[model samples]
Target chain A: MTQYTAVHGEKVSLLRVLGPGHVWALGVGIVLVGEYMGWNFAVGKGGALAALIACWAAGMLYTCVAMIDSEVTSTVAAAGGQYAQAKHIVGPLMAFNVGLFLVFAYTMLEAANAITLGYLVQTVGGMAGFADTHDKPFIVLTIMFLAFLNYRGVYATLTFNLVITAIAFVAILILFAAVSPWTDNVLKPHELLNGLPYGWLGVLAAMHFGMWYYLGIEGTTQAAEEVRSPARALPLGTMTGIITLLIAATMTWYICSGLMPWEYLGQAVTPLFDAARLTGSTPLMVLLFVGTIFSTLASANGCINDASRAWFSMGRDRYLPQVFGAVHPKYRTPFRSIVFLVPVALVFAYFAPLDQVITFSILSGLLEYTFMAFNVLMFRKMWPLGTIKRGYVHPFHPLPAFVLLALCATTYFAVFLGYGTQLVAMMVFYIIASVWFAGHRYKFVKRGAQFTMPWPRPVGH
Target chain B: MENLNNFQLLEYAAWGISALLGLWMLTDMIRTNRAHSEETLLSSKEGEIEDSLVIDPPHQGGHL
Candidate 1:
């Protein structure tokens, strides 16, 4: 009977083993790697000031996201994150698209992280005169090892993520302290700072890369069903995760902008690591190197855990296939889904260009945000606040929703400024996926069975 | 596959590890499938419950 609804406390479902701390780890783990590497691309686009503005701008977008996501995820409390929210709040077609967005976003990010891990190994080998070292082996090892941990259980997977994420985060703070000393300041913001080089257009262009600051932070809710208490842990974990990212992103931009001139800062492959090297501290360099490697590993690990869950949630509803929905008897995990998505991630990790792969990921995420903006608005209209018990109500009723839509539109335009072709390509990709789901697949979904949450019947229904 | 460099050999080893883990997951899943029905795997019903026995204590009353 409970199989019909996303009924909590089921023995066969994903285990309720995660706490707020683990949720923090999952969300932070995914996004911290961005700080260590890609966010500098914003500097390259706009200049130091543009990068900073875009960082906070994207931060504002994610703050609205975290607040809105917490409210919806708290009420819905399922595994697929926004996919679950869209299913419960909107309908099947929207839910199907959200699920695809999540799977592709995380899978692409996973592949990107895996590729970074392999390249980091090659860099290390180059330092050791083993310049011919192969990165393919490391990539394989990363995907396989992380998959194994996820296959084992959530507790182990997130616990492992927490340690490495914490280390990577501390490395950033240490860099900040070392560079920002009063009399002997290493970070010459006065010297490196150039007011927006490309002007407003550059600032807009920077917004797309600025998203890296907090892109995957919202993924904490993907483990919603598995959290010990969705109401408590969801808000606690997601909010704290955002706050951590805000601090980290600010420090990362400050440190990087000061150490390297805008031209070099914008293009450095590992900006934080490069900043550490510029300090002439071998200890900091090695620590940043390790930090970069660990952050990438943690990111890949979290991505596997998340991407598989989204795929599993879709499978459970027969949105794809029921076979992909099975929980492992002993592990209490979406084992089949984990197994199925591994090869897809590996294929991209091995072959695809990172820049294009990332554009698809960010665009997919942007599409989901578009769905979320409307989903939350509809949620309020259908359920009405105080009609149902909510764990956290975001302050200011429709402000967050309206702001989210505006931010999403702005980000989509920002994406268009740079990744215009990919933006069109992604829209085409999801549109086709949507049409296929609606035309060929909607018959399989049991709409009546889906709305079994304990909340009161929606106002109109 | 002949005359592979050390790095190429390492790649083979990594793939080998991945294959072993993959095969292990597959076989373990197969074992679980054989032991339980698809319905039990997908449903909330504890499929392992059938292997249990509720041992009834001979009431600890005045006889003790």
Candidate 2:
């Protein structure tokens, strides 16, 4: 007979699963690429002061949502993540919607990253004489590479990320220091605020752009269960990750604005790479290229892994399909979900342009964030914990949560209104998810099946 | 330098720190993983429970 521990076994410790360093690396990896791509544009349009404030606001808002997730859910495994959490709190249908949105958004992100990676390779390949290749072949190769690495499992993926993140971090610092002499000439107040559409509406629109940099704050929570001491580590690790990224992003923005002319910076195709070139170091340019490529790959890998886990969790719960729930018996990874995600990403990659893919991804993410913020408030009210844990809490409580919800909702509508095609796409996504849920429910009823949370049973009962 | 401004200094510092921190994080990952095997072995013997059970059953309308 096979031996099994009681369901209510000992709880895992954080130190064992995710060391402080790995957690930090994971946080840095998520923010670096997005900021590298868009920070200059955001700061130049909003002004340093405005950008800084927005970064803080958005970061804190994201952090609150993550903490609520950690507190409300018992375990922080990568597989179930937000979809599972939402399912537990609300009903299956809402949970299914969250899963659907997340899968769609993340798949779009994979496509975007692949395209961007192609562009990056083309840019750098110019130096190495490979010549520029367009979308299809590059996208296919990139997807295959990421899939292979992810399939190798989390350790390999994370290890690769750590190395790449380190190199990129060094390149960024060197570029910043080398260009330090040009700061005064580049830092113009009007440059910061110019090129913006106009007024408060423009600023609000700009905030939507800023939200891109803060995209993965809640992602760390998805890995909660994978980390050892989830109850303690999930909250602390996530908050620590967020705060660190906020500071890093803010500083990077300020430096980029100070070191390069905002007008020129906004128009540049490879802003960070260009910044490195301006530093008068050819080696720095190469470093920047490598760093950027690494950051993009790392971010793509993390997104695919986390997203696949969310889908798998939903699938296990019967909100999706049972196939997603099937863990690789030996690897102990969600192989089926990963398999499902890769082809969907490939299809999107083949058809969608990178910019459109990114915009759609952001729009979907905002809707999820709106629901997440609302979930936080609902969780706080419905399930009050007398003792607040060591993790950071929003100072304003319901107000901050409420404000974030309203802002996220407003941002979603604004984006939807501004982009007609994306709005239509969003509608189609919702409809598809609804139809899927109805079908799932019907099947469940036909089989006389009931849904239940995946939990540890009490020891020896 | 009259040409250089606060914005530039902040940017330099930010990038500088990111590089340093990134490098540190990498080193830490490698170092910790080396030590981790033994620690994991010890902990596995402790027979700790999974975190999933902490949730009040899903029927109670709690996040699992």
Candidate 3:
């Protein structure tokens, strides 16, 4: 049996595993892709401000879920993430389903990021030649690069994320400064009121796009086990990163709007680049293009690194194939999971359109978040106040938990109602998972496989 | 519309109430630890600590 050591022979403290700047970078990386790619399609200039508010609200809700999860798992910080946490709170049958969706969420997100990276490479001036005949090849190269970095382990991945995020930030600041002259153009009173006719329902519907910008707030929680001091670092990193992303996203939206007309932005394929052109500086445009490329790559890398861990954890628990669970002895990482994920991402990147992939990715992620939010509520009821140790708690108790549960479920159902194709696809995927889990259960029972229940028995006999 | 805004305000007030509830939960966790330690002392005196710590019945495998 291989023994797992907490420190892994390193004298690093939890704070040492991450600094505030690193946390900010991770948070910014999470939001930038959505802002750059999905924001226009999700919401227009009038709806952007509302979307920002929605993102903050969603961030708070996700933060609450993470708090409950950290306390429940004894702060073990496993890669299995919510799948591992769900298995402990709910039963394996439910967790198996959650695990399947979790894998789908991360893999789909990887595909989305890779496809976006390909487009960015093609559109950016210097790299246009690379784009002409080599779209799929570019995606494949990106997948390979991300997979290798992730396979190296968490420290290298976070360091790379920090550097990429810093570059992206500086690029955004330059773009903002260049566009500052057009600040008046960006803050149109009419644009802010454009969606007013739709009333609250329209605003809420438009929030679907806003929520996309906030999608990855829960990502760092998945890597809680890899962080040095999960108990303290997890909450601090998560909250700070979320706040930073929220501010950056809001500012980016404002800057872009200020630099161009709402009509142009609404139709823009690459709005930020267009905003850069307003500055009339070739050097700055080049920097922005490079930043966009780095942003997509960093986001893809983070998704793959976190997703592989979740898959490996499921495999270790026998919910997935045994091969996925095998850690590379030398690398101390899940080499197989990383290997499997990259190809799947590349296939989707090559075959699917960017918009379709984004929709599917967001839909799958929404389902997983709904399940997780529900699990938090369930854990609160089952474990109650006294069962756990001192860990961060959500500001509002059952109320915030209850409100998030309601809003998340409502949004999920609303999306299902609107997007019939995605609903059908999600149903088919769940049905397949159900059949696989049933088959696995039969085989295990026949072979007398040992079962480990999620919860520990009451303290004293 | 104004009434609805008031309702939103009320909802915010409710959130404030819940924040207090969260603080109460932290206090409860502290109280539970003290009680657990006392229980452990009594159980140890009665030679029940080891028995309680051990997993009963050989572990069995199946969907958990």
Which candidate has the highest lDDT of all? 1
lDDT of 3 at A142: 70
Q: Give one digit per residue, the lDDT tens place, for model 3 in A151-184.
A: 6445667788888877876777777666553546
Q: What is the C-alpha lDDT profile of model 1 across B14-52, one tens digit per residue?
A: 889988888887787787677656765676321122212
Per-residue lDDT for B25-61 in model 3, tens only?
A: 3453344334333222111110011222311112111
Worst 10 residues of 3 chain A by lDDT: A7-16
Q: Please report the TM-score between candidate 3 and the true structure.
A: 0.76
The model with the greater TM-score, 1 or 2, is 1
lDDT of 1 at B51: 17
Worst 10 residues of 2 chain A by lDDT: A6-15
Clashing pairs in 1: A44-A266
- Give a tens-digit lDDT track for model 2, residues A243-351: 6667556656666656566567654566677766666678887788787888778778777776776776666555655545544322334556776687788877878
The DockQ-derived docking category for candidate 1 is incorrect
Model 3 chain B TM at 0.41
- Give the DockQ (C-alpha) for candidate 3: 0.01
Which rank order by DockQ, best down to worst?
1, 2, 3
Give the number of the best model, judged by DockQ: 1
Docking quality tier of model 2: incorrect
Question: Which residue runs does candidate 3 get wrong by more than 4 Å?
Answer: A1-28, A44-76, A125-132, A181-201, A441-461, B1-64
